[model samples]
Target: MGKFGIAFTIAILMVACKEDPSAKEESKQGFRMTDEERNATPQVQKQPEKNFRTFTNLADTTFIRLADFSDGFAYDLRYATENNFLKEKVYDCAECYTRVKTAKALLMANKEFEKYGVRIKFFDCYRPNSVQYKMWAIVPNPQYVANPKKGSIHNKGGAVDITLETLDGKELDMGTDFDFFGKRAYHDMTELPRKILENRKLLKETMEKHGFWSTRTEWWHYNLSGAHKDKVANFKWECE
Candidate 1:
């Protein structure tokens, strides 16, 4: 073949070898699109593989990272930083873990919350018993922090501290921040603005419908029914 002909053939082969962008998008969203549609739609960047873990064959009481099972939820994880009520960084890394049963309940509750245009945004979940001690040392008040010797439902992997946020990540007004430790944060606090009360009611009622109950004093805290029966656990997650 002449040099011109050989160069033309090589260019065609290179084009055929290139990966299809639509195929990558299809794998991420589980929907296929034609070339024209792909060109018109905006691209969504994929999150890291750590968020895609599965729960196959996992036991109901076994602890699993919540992010691995769903992308619909958001996390703030205040204890991983010094921003919490304790004003101390108690965790080496920010991670949300819960028992399989509790995670299942949360997934269902979040779906319901989505109908109202909001979803669960977690502050804490499945805290280690060791970390509970750190919190107790700072704020020994049982009204604020559970006694480490008694071990809270969080240590049992059945409780979560969460709030609601819009699908686009705007936080719903729930009257007070996480761990406010005041009457203003109470579930029975009705003196707040109409919007704040409604937001708290939505969170509390939906969680109860999913077999979780809220403490009267903490609007952001929820415990799965009977989760306190589970033993206190000191299982710590590995930090990268």
Candidate 2:
């Protein structure tokens, strides 16, 4: 009777041990992940393949797409949209093209801004002289739009309209919106809050360090020191 009882107890214990998968895994020194968990991955965007041209052979005055050089910069390209002061689209499409010298300086300045948790957000970049005429036809004011006949530094690919934006795309207050024609938009205006002044100062000072100078009338406008000599280009960029 005792031997049969012992055999029956051993058989019952063996069947009970097989019920738990986790206990089996513990014995095997492993764990099992659910199908969903095993396949889970963090979402990431693949960077576009760059076919950028080298700056070495290009002249300082050569025109180039700023995005071709670096993806770190941001662009608004207001003239390419109706949101600008003109209330009409002047550019065929939005693109930031600048002289080699201007692009080089901006790339460097943006790298510096990155250290401060900011980056440059362009409203406008190089302006074809013909687009200047289009803007003039809309505003036709020297204070607002440059005269097409004489041309501005923008026509020479030496100028850019920009502002500071946090790395997450939050725009810093610069007292007024881009192309706001008033004393508030003036760089010398100090009626603004300290935060606005500091933001503007950062932009102006860093640009100056990069060989760009600010215009007195528009806080967003800047010109490369020696880019006025380049011919005023009338060609426009292709949009697809």
Candidate 3:
């Protein structure tokens, strides 16, 4: 081998070592990347997993957060803020929880409501028994607040205060806001606009069909069937 042969071999090696962006791009389409090409590429950061929790091994009466099981429902949670009739915040944070059975019923009810292009928007769910005492301290009247000593179905984790809202999140007019104490909020009230009456009827019938019963005076309130049998719970949720 002469200097010409060695120089020609060196020239061939130099040509092979040169990078070609167009060739790399073409190979990327076929995913036939060399180790060097792969090392040079930026890695795609993986997205965070969604926090869609589950109810496996949970008891039907066990209280659990509704948002963990599904993201279908909306929440207003007025008591967590000063937006309620009590004119004060009662909860440390806004969260909705209910017994597994009640949560199952609500999931079904919301699915049915989706056919009507709406879903359940919760005002409250599974009030801590201590919160009941707080509410009673504020109202101190059986006409408005349930007796904390007896405890309402909410304390038992089988009651939810909810209203229907469009999928876009607009609330249906039920003639009155949540916590209204007058006859206007009554399920039996007939003086409301026809649209309001129809909205209440839809909410009531759907809930009742899914193992819930409504209160005569509070259209937003619904108690799961046999929920009165559960002991009132005083456990409070941790807030972040």
Best by TM-score: 2
Q: lDDT per prediction?
A: 0.93, 0.89, 0.93
lDDT of 3 at 5: 100
Give the per-residue lDDT digits (tens) of candidate 3, residues 159-186: 9999999999899999998998889999
Ranking by TM-score: 2, 3, 1
What is the per-residue lDDT of model 2 for residues 21-131, given as tens digits with 9 covering 90 to 100?
777775686767678976999689999887766698898888899888888888898888889877888777889999888999998999999999999999999999988
Off by over 4 Å in 2: 1-52
Please give the RMSD of candidate 1 to the true structure.
12.1
Clashing pairs in model 1?
Answer: none
- lDDT score for candidate 3 against the true structure: 0.93
- Taking all chains together, each candidate's TM-score versus the true structure is 0.79, 0.80, 0.80
Candidate 1, residues 153-189: lDDT per residue as tens digits?
9999999999999999999999888988789998888
10 residues in a row with least lDDT, candidate 1 = 47-56
Pairs clashing in candidate 2? none
Once fitted onto the true fold, the runs of candidate 1 whose alpha carbons sit more than 4 angstroms away are: 1-51
